[model samples]
Target: MAKGQTIKVEIKRQATPDAPSYTEKFEMPYRPGLNITSVLVEIAANPVNTEGKETSAITYDSNCLEEICGSCAMLINGKARMACSALVDRLLDETKSDTITLAPLSKFPVVRDLAVDRSVLFENLKKVQAWVPIDGTYDLGPGPKQAPQIQEERYPLSNCISCTICMEVCPQFNTQTNFVGAATIAQAKLFNMDPSGSVLKEERLRALSGDGGIQECGFAQNCVQACPKQLPLTEAISDMGRDVFIQKVKDFVSR
Candidate 1:
């Protein structure tokens, strides 16, 4: 917390997906208002370990440094959070220690260092068809109007940056369970609420009725708490769960 003070960070590094992971210690001079991304940048520029050994630049992903890109999500102090907004000062204060631990999200395959393959979330979104169906071949006239209250509810759900923090925090999101986690479910809810998008409502509900679908959610509520955008994940999950159930009943009756 003073001039010349240094912060110790232990980073889990993997050169490739199949490579073994190991920890590298770094000591960076303390800088006020420094976030984890900035620290990584400094470390990259120096590429030196605590023992003064030359090392490769840390491999990671970052963009928009403002938490919008969601590419900076990683395990900081054993918690999934956006490194761009993970303030070093706050991390130190919380841990009450000089050393901070960094690792890739455990739920995904490690690409390298703090980077992991989050393509699973996107694939899940594809499964749910999380989008408004509009063929924009030509200018379609004005769309149906939505009430202000509807917008108010949908706005928060739409803020999902696809960081996969929800997936990372979810205990149900593991290799054994095909659970899609909270983000995809929230996006399904978001699109399903749109007046125009509601045309595909039944399809979306049916999509969520299958394997690795809404019913797979264990409701640990960790996704809601860990979402960087504070999306109404639990609410969306509950709504989608009910909808999925109703769809199943309707399907049974129709058959």
Candidate 2:
């Protein structure tokens, strides 16, 4: 690594959803500890391709420059990852290729360049009712106490940032299946475990039983591997599956 070395990036670009896609190469001055977001900012500043032709700035979603926002997820060197957390040095070291590649997440509909419409994840969340039901702002007394043991178990499931990396890597997540994927399942598990939130447990279980629910998961285990927050997705899926099964049995008996 020498001073004045340039970092090469190959970005897949599309003007609109129906437009033809193309790859444009960019060269930026190498800087220590630079992330992919910073590299895209450099491209935006110049808006010139490697061929030195004037081009439009790369369109991508980014905010909270930190990894907490989870809006900067993209394919970096053929992997679904958060651009804000992906370090250039580590990426270069792993691929051993001078050029870095950026592309939109494959499982989602591309809105522009690297920014794809991730609203599907939100729609799925709505289907599951993944929150505690509460009424007006009237003061409710102290809620039921949860044991420390329960809190410890539910803590890891709450770390999901909804980045959809799990959905991207999942084999079951596609147009044909409409599988909700692991994040929503993990979230359902989180709420179901809560003392106050579990009031809707039966409804949540029924939601997971219908089309595009937990049963659609193929258990390829890709979600667990792809999750940046390291959530216990497989375990949550297993637990939720069991709960859904029990609810089905109870409903059958009552009917």
> Taking the tens digit of each residue's C-alpha lDDT, what string does model 2 give over 63-156?
9888788899999999999999999989988988778999999888888999999999999998889998999678898888999999999999
Clash pairs (backbone) in predicted model 2: none
**Residue 196's C-alpha lDDT in candidate 2?**
88
| Residue-level lDDT for 171 in candidate 2 | 90
Per-candidate Cα lDDT values, in order, are 0.92, 0.92
lDDT minimum window of 10 residues, candidate 1: 134-143
Predicted candidate 1 versus true structure: per-residue lDDT over 1-255, tens digit per residue: 776898999999999999999999999889889999999999989999999999999989998999999899999999999999999999999999999999999889999899899999889989888988877768898888999999999999989999999999998889899988899999999999999888888998998888888888888999998898999899999999999999899999999
Predict model 2's lDDT versus the native.
0.92
Question: Residue 42 in model 1: shift from native, Å?
Answer: 0.3
